[model samples]
Target: MLNFERLQILQKYYDYIQKKTGVRDYFLVGGALRDILLGIKEKLDDVDLTIAGEPIGLYAQMEKEAFSHFITEKFGTITLIPKEGVMQGIKYEITPFREESGYQDVRHPDDIRWTNSLLADAKRRDFRINAMYYRFLNIKKPVYEEKKVLDSTTLLKVLDREGFVFLENSGVLIVQNSSLIDQLLQNGQMDSDFLYYLLDIQHFAYCYGEEGEKTDSDGRFDLQIVIDPEYGIHSLINRKLETVGDPDIRFQEDALRLLRGLRFVNVINQKLLNNENKEQNADPLNKVRLFDFETETWKSIKKNHDLLKTIAKERIYQEIVKSFSEGNPFGLVALVDEAEMLPILFPALAKTKGYDQPIRYHPFDIYAHIILTLWHLQQINSNYLVRFAMLYHDVGKVGQYEQYGLNLTREEIRNILAGPLNHRFSSAELMKEDFRNLGFSNKEIEEIKRYINEHHTPGEILMGNSQNWTKRLRKLFSEVGYEKLQNLLDINIADRLGMYNPLQNSSDLTDSYYLKTLVDEIEQTEGQFKKSDLAITGADVMEHFDLKPGKLIGELLQVGFDWVLGDVKHRNVKKQILANIANYLKQKK
Candidate 1:
């Protein structure tokens, strides 16, 4: 129910709509009903509602009001959002009622049938938990009706026996009957084997498991499936990265969640076991706890987190500015790392282990270094775009390895401790092929491959003359799209950690320096480069020389700039640097 203040705002819009079109009915439903039902024992912050009949303009009226609420139209369905935290600060959304066609495609409906019957409107929805209603009547005066919100008991009644619902909390509601599952199996509403296995009716799995594909979608859950008793969702969502190789199938059913299987186990296990421990205590859920030992699952999740590269540099910049302004950036790096689809979604991350850079400057191999690399990134910068990008920066190392490997000369490795640059393409191709098998979109796989290609040039690290630190910064910005700059430092740090090669008895002397250098850079490199702050302008160089500001002048300026960054002698005098460049150009001529 709206409080006095909300009632006034709601009544004002209600009257405006009624005056415009004599409409008599307006009420709430969907999430509001679910919340109200759930709120009997729990606190709810916002109310959601639906109007039985209303045109598009009603939404405009809601927006015109003084209070803050969201308004949008999704697939011709009008929606309104109210300010969050009125009661306890819950966000509210109001949407119009309309019929949806069956999910003919896995993503969204093909058509919508308009409706006046709100009950009929919600009936064809996917989940029983989502299909609920609450009604209201509009009058000259604010007439509030007191109706019984569906309590936990009432909701439990109509849920089909095979239907399953679990609360975010410990509430469990299941329909014991198999009629719906059986009907779905026959009529092809669902794959019988998945329903059976997923619901733990293991006995019935053989009935539908083998032929499920011929009886179902083009993609079959065939021989590749290796279900270890210990491998499950809890292990998947852990801080450790795990890759769900078949993301298409894992996500196709209920993909939004990282690991729904664990959520099910959480509720189902409570019903299955109560432990007082040795004396009969509630069992701390052995099955749920056991998955941590699943080596394969741990490998997958680790791969997944391993594969998630970074956000673009420009986006990182904005988030940092916002964090500074708001004083609470909300730890976006942790959020990105924690997202379920990240490893698979970002294939570059999925393949992070291909190259094992010798541990010279860091304690960990490339993979382990990336994790600690993230820790170093976080303490220095907090935004998602920056920290995450840093985490993902060397992600291309996977792609760069083969090219780096094939070109390796024993002479160079013994002396410089690095490999050649040609390997990124071959490595990228291998990874791209792998991604194709795993079902990632083509565009992303390509971008990630290119990212690996350009991100870490051995020349930059070793013999090739360097770009001015700022130009190198500009190069990364230009290549990956400037949106992710602030966090790209993560890649450099991770790469630095890759330089670490620990010895059996102690640390390598060279590695200690590399580690110290990387650790030093975390604090040294923050907010280090930008076009807005530079010693010499592009215009200044052009004006000083008899040169136009085209490629030649830019090249000459760049050389001078590098000398300064490399700390070459006489670098403080721009004239001396420019004179050195002019002499080098004359010798070439």
Candidate 2:
């Protein structure tokens, strides 16, 4: 059951609609109903409803009353929002019952025909568990006698007692068999009058099956009871999930669902495992089952793997974002690999799988190391940029390693390792195409590239002697802002943790203590190394030197700026800095 407060809110809307437009045949549908049946008490902020009649007319009437509403005639849907009522700012999407056809694109339907039948609309849904409805009904007004003289009362006498007593009752009523309500009412020993009232309405909460057959059992149970041991909705949800229609056809129609289904399975399995430790003899119905595709679904995914390539990158990106948002994105990524969808979705990532790495430092191969790095990122930070940076950080290694030969000179190896020709820059270059395809903004793409190119700089700085550490640190800080520097440091740490071996002493390449300490120092200084931190601006330089706003002033200012970085005390000595700049300019002249 939904929270009583939510039901009250739904009732309020139902009443408003009926009072304004005289329409009462509205059915609450989709995930809102599913959540209610699952006994979830969270707010059903996005309410989906199906109206038996014209939703556009209702929208128009709602608009006249100063309510906010919008209609999409393509799908025969209307979004009604109350501008000032109790539901203010809450969106309620009301669509006329619809039946669709011609799914040629395997996504949107080519034809949508509105219908008045709820069962027909229910049958058009994607999953049986999600194909359910809740009809809000007003309780019949109570009849009462004011005085004890009703036995011999005439019509006129009954009219005289009309002012004696008034009775009003309102609650949500669902359609179901009397026996079920009888069981609940009897079990709870509810009032006889309430039972009579429920019997009078003859509606109970029930879920629809794939074929639109109304069943007393919860639809979620039908799909999940096999893998989940508990009896209630939570168990039904927590257990393995299966599809309603042919799995292959479903995958072929919407390829994004394939990835989304896998993500659901990964998330649910993790939840189930967690629940097992916390719960004893847990009811399957009480378990929280997300979406789970069937075994055939997995098989269908493999068979129709090429179909994923045709799906929009935006759709694929949304699924990836959702999976990464979960606690165990690694599991989802693994499932994608197992299903062979990785090659279609992310070929670069797939290519990393078999690439070998130096075993002394990297316990796993290139691909395994990337996954481990991602896992470490999840533990340390939730920033998507950092996570994505780590994902493509070493993709260039695959191409770089292939160019290696035993006859290479020491100088050539040193140049390859230290120069822009290395994998870091190469990986950044390769990631541009993929990131653009994934709909990342140019700015975001640039940030990822910068992070990838500079991810190794922290370690490089740590390897340097203390005499040059400040200069290197200042240069690094000036290049990347404070926040991005922190992200780079996180990636560096994840990189080290990714290469750590449990059996052996930790590798120096993986050490992060010094890097963390440097981060602390940088934060304490608050980016004072940046050129912008110079006390004298370009304007000041121009004024003091009696020069125009030209490049020479910038060059002169840079000399002063370097002096400040070289010694912190020089920052406060503006007069001495200006005199030094003058002496240098005179020599240049």
Candidate 3:
């Protein structure tokens, strides 16, 4: 199912190479081919080309013809930059068949050897589905249909003459023999009228791999797609992530493949969800379902989970982010826990696993509550920072209870742990160190720290009956800015919903809505909120106190702002602000 426009561009390049070198030994390989087989409609921009023989002669000729190319001689690969025609802004990395060995560092190969067989090259790849190859052939485009044909009797008669059958119920076409379609196309037995109906059938490609070969003649009748030496198409049709050969050997060769396997599961499940939501009328045979790891693959991943420690923290961080950001995040966490990689990744968060909370506030233990909180954030499409903050917001409770349990009864401890505490500040402190280890930027670390520290402020403001809410909120807005306050409110709502208690609907939900509406109303107004909005400046403080520009000047101004924060009318009166600063200086002296 190659895109018609992309197929034309590929055909042009194929023809150009065939004419230049007088040989046709190249094929399209890797992710581009995989995406085509999966019926993904996104534009296929990056493509890879592989040849069975040497690529130097072709690379030299293309370089001489003024094509921009970069070559890595040792790896036997060349990246060609096509800057003109239909292939503009596309890169084609052409590589000769090669085998790798000796992965001592667990990331790169120590040696590479050239081979002349496509099957040999396929055996050394990561997964079965990515080992296939595709070639563009010279033929007319096959007929394709987006809607069902009403005249099924005439179409079935034509297909029956060609030894094929059309299943009207599922809209799938099946060949009487596995090789019958290939033989007919090769021997020219398929007439134009018959070929039109043959290619136009929906989900016709599902019947392709059973006979040990797969073909895609959609955009090109001579489309010899999927040289699947490892039965990649079968694995794909079964919705399984399988290694090329021995799962253990593959994991031993590259430890990163374990996380990659998990990520593929996440990515495929996301695709399935997207299809269910967006493609209701899609053919059943073509719909992707929930993907899972083959039994052997899952076992190998668990057995080799320790190899992840050898990987760089940055790499592990990237894989974790990719796994959780786009797909079923709860599934990602559960899989990571099942593989026993959670303790190694985040030990502090892992310590909260068995720590139970009071049933009145949380039906689940601390760890499950954290996971549910993360899922709630996911339902609202929160960014990764907020999700990560929620994942560890309550982790400090473990240490908090342990340190204070010496003096309290069991019931008293549970009641104490059921509510928010200074543990949030402790969690923020611990998170800073973890962020430093995981290579988070300084700005990112500070933002997450604020999220953890201020997550409970909105709940306090909304649930409490206080007359100074305007002052507290305006001061909070001044301290962290407006955007961060808004995000903290989101975290508050998610945290409350993650709890399982009677007050969730009455106090929690109503309070959250009230807080949101209050903020929105305040945002719509043009009232002054912070020290910067005051009429008195730092210069006023320095001049009135006979002080130079230093920390004292800023401190005096802050004191002045605090004095007027209780009443908005006092903010614009410079005389009163200076008088307040004078009183603050007298008290300090």
Candidate 4:
């Protein structure tokens, strides 16, 4: 018996479609099939169906049933959503069997032709493992319980003479359909050789074809059923799965697949390592090997790495985000570097690879330091903004010595090298286009820039004496805001931990205690630190000094705000402020 519980949704939808349009050539394809075969029990929110006939006919039938659907005539696909039933709210994407022609842009098909052959459609998919399909047959009894309703028995219905067949685990079962079998055999649609060939089990040599079948008195044959064990003999077989066509041609057809291939390599390596940890003596033969591409594929990618530049920035950004979101982002990035795509995708990161830092402060070069910082962020489970900040934090250090020259005075060098003013600002300025091109929202890009610009301020404040530290801390907090201050501290801590030295272990660059105390003090203190917080406004200044709304009012407020920053008591001295404004105006005249 088939796994009826696992096949209920497919069966229900198949039956519904067949009842409506009398179409029986639909099959469950794509990731749903791959996930089912992998025994991954995660809840899948979408179902993809490939039908051998016109989907628009099914679309018209579904419309009569009042089912909502979206049609795309360009690709011959329709997304149907049932209004009521066990599969309510679920979206099923139904597409007619079609083949793609040219991909001169490396992203889209230049021409699409409808086909009636399932095999032809399967051959056009990206990978062998994702190319399988599952066909389900309708039966008389209730196949499985519907979890969404209380009365499951009400769903059962008797079938007519049309008959039904269910395909499961890459094998098809015809239920009470001997005539359909004979029809398939005569029409060259469902012969045993074709079935076994589709299942990749022909090597077992269990023939169910016309040559070796036992015929009943009515001339119907009973074929021997061949099932692969759970830990099947196929696991022992080694097969190299190339792309459907030439690997170079595939990459040229879609350059994004190059990055996808690298991601797969890292993902496969991680899975292998996890499996190795679970079973110390696991057979090496049981592991799925990485896809070994032809040498020409690598050559084509290296030659056409710039083709990635031609792809939509949003698409490239999505691939980059997926790479970083994986368990092994560092490894994946290393692979990107190996493929020479990093320079094209992230020229900022590429420039940092060999740039050296002062040995006393940094143990690794600029690129390694950034990677180490990212590793720290990963350890803390930091969000993407913090991780991205760490990635570009020190990229501005490249060519700094040559740009600024080596003969600068200590104070001048410090001013130029300060995070907020020079390197951080420069890096943020340089990355604006890169970040925007990578599909980051304007708000996200600004926030990242804020983090990079202020990453060093927290440490600077923490290392200061308490005398002026509050003022500095308040300024930093006001500039970066409360939410971003936390992120800035995270980047600071990661950057400090990433530095190389004997004392690195002892450093608390984030200075959580001190920063927290500063936060608490700022919260408790009611005095003005900003011009807007001054007790006297620009209107007060203009009225008291007998001046209209002009530059003089703003100048007077700045002087008062400066005094307030140095001593909060200055905010209450209205008469003294008026006297100071007069003197300041006298000096200006």
Best by TM-score: 3
lDDT by residue for model 1 (1-589), tens: 1011111223233333333323334544333333222221133344554554444655654442423444464554443333322322334445555666544333355666655554445444332333443222211111113223333243333232324321111111122234433432332123435433433432122110011112114332211111111111122223122223344332232222223222222322222222122234434563322112134433333344422233232332343333322222223222334544434444455456434664544444555556556555555555533443344555545545544466757675443333332344444555565455444456655554554454455225432333344444433443443433333434444445444444432222353344334424532543233332335556766776666768977777666665554433335365676576778688879
Model 4 ranges off by over 4 Å: 1-25, 32-41, 64-69, 80-92, 135-242, 264-306, 325-328, 404-406, 411-415, 418-421, 466-482, 503-547, 550-589
lDDT digits (tens) for residues 247-334 of candidate 3: 9989888898888888878866776677567865888776546678999999999999999878877887787777667677777888
Q: TM-score for all predictions?
A: 0.42, 0.72, 0.74, 0.67
lDDT of 3: 0.67
Across 1-589, the per-residue lDDT of candidate 2 in tens digits comes to 1221233434455556556444555666665555444334245567777765655665655433645766898887887676776667767778877777777777777888877655556556655445555543322332333223212123123223321111111122232223433342332223346534533442222222212212233321111100001111222333434444677766666666677677656654554455454677877866544445556756887787777777777887777776666536777777788888877766788888888887777877899998888888877777777788888899888877765655677787787877665999888987887878877779888988998998888877777786766666666676776677778888888887788776545445444666566656866865546676677788888888778977888799888876666555445377877877888888888
Instruction: Compare the candidates by lDDT and give the number of the best one.
Output: 3
Better of 3 and 4 by lDDT: 3
Q: Return the TM-score for candidate 2, rounded to 2 decimals.
A: 0.72
Candidate closer to the true structure by TM-score (higher is better), 1 or 3: 3
Candidate 2 runs further than 4 Å off: 1-25, 32-41, 63-68, 81-90, 135-235, 266-292, 418-420, 466-479, 502-530, 539-556, 566-572, 576-589
On the 0 to 100 scale, the lDDT of residue 325 in model 4 is 64
Query: How many steric clashes between backbone atoms does each model show?
Result: 51, 24, 0, 4
C-alpha lDDT (0 to 100) for residue 376 of candidate 2: 82
lDDT of each: 0.39, 0.61, 0.67, 0.59
Screening candidate 4 with a backbone cut-off below 3 angstroms (N, C-alpha, C), the clashing residue pairs are 135-167, 136-166, 137-165, 137-166
